[model samples]
Target chain A: SQTIHQWPATLVQPVGSPLSLECTVEGTSNPNLYWYRQAAGRGLQLLFYSVGIGQISSEVPQNLSASRPQDRQFILSSKKLLLSDSGFYLCAWSVPWQPQHFGDGTRLSIL
Target chain B: GIQVEQSPPDLILQEGANSTLRCNFSDSVNNLQWFHQNPWGQLINLFYIPSGTKQNGRLSATTVATERYSLLYISSSQTTDSGVYFCAPLVSGSRLTFGEGTQLTVNP
Candidate 1:
């Protein structure tokens, strides 16, 4: 079975602080990876998605960026965080045009 | 970009009740998935029904791909079933677009 793991389950950072969240998938290769953000009481918003290594697509440009350094490793980063960046971040992986499997998610608070 | 909409923005039910949630999409979708976002904010994939029907214990889902709509049926609802139900549609790629979600509150 395939599984996704995301860390720093919960993060608290001051505004302007750097942010780095990592997501790794095990038991699957060449899977499609995605990063989504759900603001408090809001629906999930697609941030970035990658089909292969070094390929990333941004849905809504903002303070964050994504990198798929390895086939099973994806990273979400930001040079500086903003208060508006606080939200629940989720990482997911799936096959071509298939249902997605999500990680537990990281609760980020930008104070 | 495709538009996805979920009906009954908010629903409250007593334990053991049955409920049906609906999702409608603006265009043809290659994939349709139902997810339950728990109170702790963990998204649990419920069903991956793009067409036809699928059931998992107390939950069942049906998607009419041609009609651009899907239905999720929850039987014998429990407190644990109280959460936000989201319907996501995948269009050209595997990247899914999610609906606003149906908030379900199952009271004891």
Candidate 2:
């Protein structure tokens, strides 16, 4: 069975601080990776997705960026975080013609 | 881009009650999926019924591609089933447009 892992489970960072969230998949290779965010009262929104290593697509324009360093490892990063960047960040992986599976997610709070 | 709409934005039910959730899409889609987001914020994919019916345990889902709609049925609901149900449809490529979601509260 395939599983996705995301960390840290919860994060508290100061405003204007750097941010880096990591997600990796096991039991699958070359799967598509995605990053999504859910505000306090809003639905999940797609932030970025990657088809392969070094390939990334931004769904919504924002301060966040994504990178695929390995076949199953995706990283979401920001040079300087904003107050609006606080939310629940999730990482998911899926194959072609298949349903996406998500990780536990990280609750990021900007102070 | 595709538009997704979920009906009955909020629903409340008692334990053991059966309930149905509906999802309507604005255009044709290549894939349709139902996900349950628990109160703790974990999202579990319930079904990937792009154009058919599938059931697992007390949960069943049916998607009509021709009609651009999907339905999720919960049988003998439990308090643990209290959460948000989201319907996402993939129009083209790998992006999935998500609906606002239906918040279901099952009381014991």
Candidate 3:
């Protein structure tokens, strides 16, 4: 019965603006959280992952960063967004080395 | 780091047809998963086959860990099955790396 929730189902941001996307999970504690971005017609790209609060691992260097402020809350943020930062952002949670459960993604459009 | 690849990048099948999607991975994986991303951009986990075969209704999945590959079989496809199928692998951690999905279209 675990569920993941993401906010601002759709977002439109002007270039050079700040960005913040939140993800929260219920029915589970101490689960792993991840942030992935998918560009149009492209594969899902791993941006960041956290195993616990205040612990995050970046897969690729980019304009975005992720933070696990709470056990079940993860936030993806950027001080200044770029045009290339536009994509569908997904939040996922999983047990240690297990299959992941994803939230309905947020479609971000940076114009 | 592990690399995952899915074959037949695009497939078109008529309703009631059967299709098999293949996933090949480099390096040993402790977890292999199949996901269906609907047109609405919701990702639904289809299978979590690490080293065996499992069947769920009209869908079945088989993973040969030793061979480093997995297969997802969809029987009697429906228009609802038209979407992107993604294969991802997890190795000793919760983070998963995904393969470029296979776009399947089931024409009604």
Candidate 4:
């Protein structure tokens, strides 16, 4: 069975600080990875997706960026975070024409 | 880009009741899936019905791809069923566009 792991289940960062969230998948190779954000009481918004290593696509312009450093490792980063950057971040992996599997997600709070 | 719409933004039901959630999409899609977001914020994939009907235990889903809509049916709802239900449609490539979701509250 495949599983996804996301780290720092919860995070608290001060404004303008750097941010880094990592996600990894096991039991699968060359899977499609995605980053999503969900504000309080809102639906998830796709932030970025990657098809392969070193290939990332930004769904929306914002303060965040994504990188696929390995076949199953994806990272979401920000040089300087904003208050609006606070939300629930999720990582997912999937194959073509298949349903996505999500991680536990990280609750990021910016002060 | 595709626009996905889910109806009945909010629903409240007593335990043992039945409910149906609807999702509509603009433009064609493949790999349409239904997910249940628990209060703990974990997304549980409920169904992967792209163009047909599938049933899993107390839950069932039907997707009419030609009509660009899908429906999820929950039978004998339980308190554990209380959560947000989302329908995501995969467009070109592997990007899944999600609907706003329907919040279901099953009172025990």
Q: What lDDT tens digits, residue by residue, belong to model 2 across residues A14-37?
A: 999999999999999899999999
Chain A TM-scores in order:
0.98, 0.98, 0.97, 0.98
Q: Using Cα atoms with residue i matched to residue i, what is each candidate's TM-score against the true structure?
A: 0.97, 0.98, 0.98, 0.98
Worst 10 residues of 1 chain A by lDDT: A92-101
Writing each residue's lDDT as its tens digit, candidate 1 over B1-108 gives: 788989999999999999999999999988888999999888999998879999999999999999999999999999999999999988877878899999999999
What's model 3's lDDT at B10? 98
Clashes per candidate, residues 3 or more apart or on different chains: 0, 0, 0, 0
Error of 3 at A63 (Å): 1.0
Summarize candidate 1's per-residue lDDT along A52-109 as a digit string, tens digits: 9999999998999999999999999999999999999999999875679999999999
Of 1 and 3, the candidate ahead on lDDT is: 1
Number of the top-ranking candidate, with TM-score as the measure:
4
Taking chain B only, the TM-score of every model is 0.98, 0.97, 0.98, 0.98
What fraction of the reference structure's interface contacts does model 1 contain? 0.85
The per-residue C-alpha lDDT of model 3 at residue A60 equals: 94
Go through the candidates in order and give each one's DockQ.
Answer: 0.82, 0.79, 0.84, 0.85
Q: Report the lDDT tens digits of candidate 3 across residue range A28-47.
A: 99999999999999499889
Clashing pairs in 4: none
Tens-place lDDT digits, model 3, residues B72-93: 9999999999999999887767
Question: Pairs clashing in candidate 3?
Answer: none
Please list the residue runs of candidate 4 whose C-alpha ends up more than 4 Å from where it truly belongs after superposition: none
In candidate 3, position A23 carries an lDDT of: 99
